[model samples]
Target: MLHVYIEPVPKGQWGPIDGYRIETQDGTRLSGELLRSERLAVSQAKLHGYVPLLATVRIPDKAVAEHWTPADKAPVTV
Candidate 1:
């Protein structure tokens, strides 16, 4: 299970104001044109077999990264 960290795009960041950005715990970033909202970004991560986590605050791009053990990649069932 890949743990993905998600947070909103900062006020003056590169992405849209209402957009969300996602990245893995290991600092691997994921990009998408449709990540216009937090829910959409989480959904996208789920679709990629990643477990999404919401961040309380914005995380710096150059922050130290840590790897996590892989878990089940089972598809989410409605």
Candidate 2:
């Protein structure tokens, strides 16, 4: 499983779902646009050790990238 750093986006525009900037491997990152369920799923996956490699998810609401500028500078929550 790919362990990632999850951080909330306080100034995001994803409505009540809340935006978060996820940090992934190889300097990749993405900004929040996840539905509440999706966010919860990712969070749970990170916490639990039962995720399959094929089912592993990359970060930031499925928009994998080299990195998110704010995530690098922003403080982490939870």
Candidate 3:
């Protein structure tokens, strides 16, 4: 089976927006657009006949900063 590895594009390496990077067993690598979503990236790879084997998706720092809440500040649950 064709194997494809998907991972996040590091900040500033490509652009401001977080994108996905795909690497194949044959050493072929492709970086998605600055604004490409993980799903979209995977879909594009699938179109090219790459089978998903291992995928890693990282939340953008901007997004984590905006959505993350400290445990101390989280609402108490019963």
| Residue range 1-78, candidate 1, lDDT tens digits | 757876566633565356666776565678655367666777888888888766443444425333221223323212
- List the lowest-lDDT window of 10 residues for candidate 3: 69-78
Q: How many collisions between residues are there in candidate 3?
A: 0
Return the clash pairs for model 2, or none. 28-66
> Model 3: which residue pairs collide?
none
Error of 2 at 42 (Å): 2.3
| Candidate 1: segments with Cα more than 4 A from true spot | 11-16, 58-78
User: By the lDDT metric, which is better: model 2 or model 3?
Assistant: 3
Assess the local accuracy of residue 38 in candidate 2 as a C-alpha lDDT between 0 and 100. 34
Q: TM-score: which is higher, 1 or 3?
A: 1
Model 1 backbone overlap count: 2
Model 2 lDDT vs. the true structure?
0.39
lDDT value for model 3: 0.49
Off-target runs (Cα >4 Å) in candidate 2 are 10-18, 30-78
Pairing residues by index, what is the TM-score of model 1?
0.58
Q: If the candidates were sorted by their lDDT against the true structure, best first, what order would they fall in? A: 1, 3, 2
Report residue 3 deviation for candidate 1 (angstroms): 0.2
Tens digits of per-residue lDDT, candidate 3, 44-75, equal 66787766433322343322333333222434
